[model samples]
Target: MVWTVMPDFEGYDEACSQFIWDLPASYNPAVDFLRKHENSDRVALEQAYPDGRREQYTFRELDELSDRLAVGLADLGVEAGDRVAVVVPQKPQNPITHLANWKLGAVSVPLTVLFGTDALRYRLDDAGVAVAVIDPTVRDDIDAVRDDCPALEHVIEIETNAPAGDVHAFEDVLTAPEHTDIEPYESTPDTDTAILYTSGSTGPPKGVRHSHALWLGRAAAAYNFFDQGLGPEATVWTPADWAWGAALGGTLFATWHHGGTIVGYPASGFEADEAFDLLAEFDVTRSFMPATALRLLMEVEDPTAAYDLAIETFAVGGESLTPEIVDWIAETFDSVTINEFYGQTELNLVVANNSNWFDTRPGSMGKPLPGYDLAILDPDAADRGVAERLPTGELGEIALRPHDRSVFFDEYWHMPEKTAAKEVEGWFVTGDLARQDDDGYVWFKSRKDDVIITSGYRVGPMEVESAILEHPDVVQAGVIGVPDDTRGEIIKAYVEAAEDAPAHETLREAIQSVVREHLAEYEYPREIEFADALPQTTSGKIRRKALQEWDAQGSVDEESP
Candidate 1:
């Protein structure tokens, strides 16, 4: 599919020069995705499962399905402003649940299928979910915590065999009368649409609430980062879970807002060969991938050599992209450059390396997207109630002005104190460290908790990890600071060697030598440990916290003398 009206941008300067921040008083994402493409029978979602089953749905079909589900849910006593938890795998039903909730002016709380019983119970109880739409596969997990969730009243099962006692079958819900006379709820821009929980790396996952306007605000991202205009014919895909904001907001909502198609596939785990196959099979035009997934994909022998890929734009996030991975992609794919974006579940897509607007910088996180005011402020200023912007090239905490209501989140659900702690004066502290160059490009450093201070020098693990990745034998790398009596904190590198590489003293010296050449001698790792695998989060981020704990427990092998 080709766009009816192509996107126009002179360059990065012109694209960021102006933006439209006005949102309609009353807006619904479901209405926008369907009404804009109502006249055309374009495919909205195409699902491919590992079991060799494929499903395709048009915009009209999804509209009807969500409409029926909304009416059916309303029949089950769900009302406006109520909390409804949606836990499903990557399928058409996932987005359907979101649209259904929006249609009723109800809040949709997305939960990843990876969550265990305890994690599920915490979020369900915290959000006070009134009704839950869950995939049948995890029914038992929910059932284990059902008695604990006092606010949970009903359970609706989707993609399952039959309805058990008290469990409402999704098939039955969809069987609602075709012409059920249920009027769509009229929700203002301020009406709540979703409560997305963070990955809970530091502590318990916080429920980040977003209004309908916040969902609609992603349009600027669709334009600047995606290089898409109205009625774009782009087919978007991402390996990230639908529950995460990157997939929900970045891929699904962004693509639909531009009237583009979304491609989805079911895989037990990520396989580079299968991913390449899906790209070629569906002829995906645009895609988003986490850096971890990209690293794994690059490990495959000649990833792009075998497939006839139609992907034109590839955007990566969730972690930093090293120069090694960027160069690998450049050499493998024809006319394809890696576009990196920076955002969190709380704030969708704030900063990006937009290839359409500017050249793709390997390590730079790019400038802020239109409609956002971003800066590097002194971290100590958080207690003073006024953010002090650091000079160019000075590393500091990244902060955003909270006045951008169209793009910023409303609050953390049921946690007023925590929400209040996130703001200082009028700035919302992102808690991530970064520095901006004079050219207006922002370079991501590390999370505030992940930054290391050793021997009177500050170091971001990303730079060290990037340097280590340049070695031929390294498949993946994780860097952390260990307790040191002399240096306060010393750099320790955990290297995951390639399948054929051996763990030896000579290899460790070679890895350290690369860092010494690329960075200062103080930044190089003093100790290197070859490991079979590194700890990672379900969302594909390296779990530095876990690595830190392992170091505390002395789980890492001692460095060779």
Candidate 2:
């Protein structure tokens, strides 16, 4: 019943010195995250609806429900290693479906409900999913893609009053006579657990294969970064979709792993007011926030005066935190500990900030977690798996030597070449580029290809975008490299301004000036373009590739040379 990193840590250095990898001999998410707590009276989940309603469930209740669902899935012909797609929002059904899949030793394919027919078909067909458990909202999308995904055998919809289709209802399936007295599948520590797809920022989304071992690595990071430990009284929440590994593993499972409570808002996206309300209403102490969510929260004024919040820990990532945004968090949440963590969806929780153990640095991702061996390496040598370490303060690809394979992903599902390309010598190369300070903190620069080369100088687009975000009128910004006969490539910026700010030459010059002052003068964008909105991914990433394409086609509105 005891957990490591509980109740007290002398300091960050000691935690690292004494910390050891606690990999379990046998692991299954259904057991480690849920079943172990089935006898306890602790609350497991409290999900909220936009229509002013909240539902709470205990670990014991979920254990029994998942057992029934597991039995139903088996009846539907699902077996060990078969993929079961989960396409639902942040309701109890989302976690229940995942638990059922893992209980049956089946691999879960979690797709966001935001996906359309093409997106759904690609993942369903690729993962060879046999059964899909979905929300009524996305049932039509699943129906449209069923023909293309021949492996999809049946669609099970969550109980809703809406007209039922040919598919079976979730509640009806759980009530079957076979639901009782079924034995759960046994699993090893290395048993393949889930296949999570990437954000597809660069190209098509690749399925990332994970095992039961992934939880230990992610939980360890959460333990330290989430203010040393989360106890039974702790209530955790995040604006991130449960489909993302960061939210599911880093937030949901991590909370239940410690017998704590988790709150969920099953909305499609983030709203600043709702974020504060959820935190206040649930008395949420632990929170995992993406940078976009923080940015959205920043738009509001004096939130502490508006909401009765009891937040203690604010763990943030998913993108770079502009200097301004960082300052706003420190000032606004004066009572909360703000820890800025860093990692890609492919391999997360490796590097993070724990302010309770050390001095929190501004604009820096904290030191590597205890079990991880991380370093900055030559990006060019990464594809060949060459372990070449870059000097301190030098920007290079962040790489890790998987001393423990459980903490990292197994491989890109069915993409060995892509997986192999991720390593440098024996180190796993993170596609992200950063510089490590002498004190061992990492400062993220940008993605590998996102570095813009202009007139014999290299520029990180994030630095430019961050600077532009500091402007009073700027709402969103995207930066890219454009081909130029003279400079090889020139830095260009696309900006979305506020209603009060006009798309004029003066506004462009003012934005350019901010960047020049914040970073090197050469790093400022040479060309500025104004638009009503900049292209962004569903996760709030500024799609610079789309910006480049638009620029190439000369379709940018109000472009200024």
What TM-score does candidate 1 reach? 0.94
- In model 2, the Cα lDDT at residue 37 comes to 57
Per-residue error for 494 in candidate 1, Å, reads 2.9
After superposition, candidate 2 runs with Cα above 4 Å error: 1-8, 161-165, 176-178, 502-504, 556-561
Q: Over all chains combined, what TM-score does candidate 2 have?
A: 0.95
**Model 1 has how many clashing residue pairs?**
1
- Candidate 2 lDDT, tens digit per residue, 284-310? 998998776787788889999999888
Clashing pairs in 1: 12-357
Model 1, 84-187: lDDT tens digits are 99898788888998888888889999888887899899999999999999987779999999999999999999877687777888877764655555567887
lDDT of 1: 0.80
TM-score of each: 0.94, 0.95
Candidate 2: 10-residue stretch with minimal lDDT: 1-10
lDDT of candidate 1 at residue 401, scale 0 to 100: 63
